[model samples]
Target: MDTLLSIFDVKLAIENLPFVLSGLPMTIAVAFLSMGVGALLGLFLALGRGSSYRLLRWPTRIYISFMRGTPILVFLYVLYLGLPEVGIELTAFQAAVIGFGLNSAAYIAEINRASLNSIDTGQWEAATTLGIPYWRTLGGIILPQAARIAIPPLTNVFLDLTKATSLAAVITVPEMFQKAQIVSGRSFDSLTMYITVALIYWPLCIVISAFQERLEKRFSRYVNE
Candidate 1:
């Protein structure tokens, strides 16, 4: 019982609550900013991958492959440490955002591509039959349908991105995990600080997932109609 109880210290965790919570804003900011950057780049890459032109298609494919293939930690190191060797310097926050954003974009691009492909061919046929421009058909009709289809997966990706921000602590970005580390080091209560951090992440993911489910159900109704 002593060993089991020692595994977690609820009292210490509660005591450190305010200190760990202080990092919440920075964590949210990193996640939001990274995902925003990812969405734009991912959308662009998805369009490029779908293009018939070899120039656009080949490079986009290669980029997606490389980004997806590389580990996130390596990419973060490349941004935070490697870039400085090339005469480019960025603060920890900037590096975290850029690194995480670029990594998230590759996954997001694939998600967008799959969603875009899932769209009904008949919709494209009807648009083409009506003499709608390719870009207009894609932007106005196809994308809306794809967006609904993509929401659930995209929300999962966002949740993943939010958790990935913890890796920023490695580069000294002072996110939630970093704060927990600082508090734990000073308090000598690793288990409590870690549990507190996990608690924080658990709820954020739960909320995002709950919202995703609601959106998915709403979109399904549109499909059924």
Candidate 2:
């Protein structure tokens, strides 16, 4: 008990809780902003991947493959550190968002592609026979069904992005883990600070997971109706 208490330092954790939590907003901001960018770009990539034109399909395929193959940390470093050498400057926050966003887009594009492809071919034929435009059919009929299929995997991506925001600390984005590091340095209690941050991340992930369950249930109900 004494050894554990010395290692954990509950009092220190409690005292630093608010300071660590002060970075929550930045963590959430990076996550959602990156998700927004990923979703939008990913959708276009999905569409291009399925396009008949070689120009579109091949390029999107290459982009997705390249992004997925690389580690996100290296990409973040490239954007935050390397870009300035090329005369393109970006702030730490901007670099984190763009790096995570672009990296996630590859994964999201694959998910979107699979979901879109799962829809029945007959639906497309039926819509075409009805003289509905491709865009309208996609927007009205296909995407809604595909979205339901996508929710689970997309939620997983979001969960990952949320946790992955901690990596932004490397770029000095001042997120939760970064704050924890500061506290650890000041107090000389790295184990306690890290454990505290992990506890904070635990509840945050739990909330996201619970929200995902609710979203899945709601979508299931819609589908049933």
Candidates' TM-scores? Answer: 0.93, 0.97
* Model 2, runs deviating above 4 Å: none
lDDT of 2 by residue, 1-225 (tens): 999997999999999999999999999999999999999999999999999999999999999999999999999999999999999999999999999999999999999999999999999999999999999999998988888899999999999999999999999999999999999999999999999999998899899989888888877754787
Q: Where's the lowest-lDDT run of ten residues in candidate 2? A: 216-225
Q: Each model's C-alpha lDDT?
A: 0.91, 0.95
List clashing residue pairs in candidate 1.
none
lDDT of 2: 0.95
Best-performing candidate as measured by TM-score = 2
In TM-score terms, candidate 1 sits at 0.93
lDDT of model 2 at position 142: 90
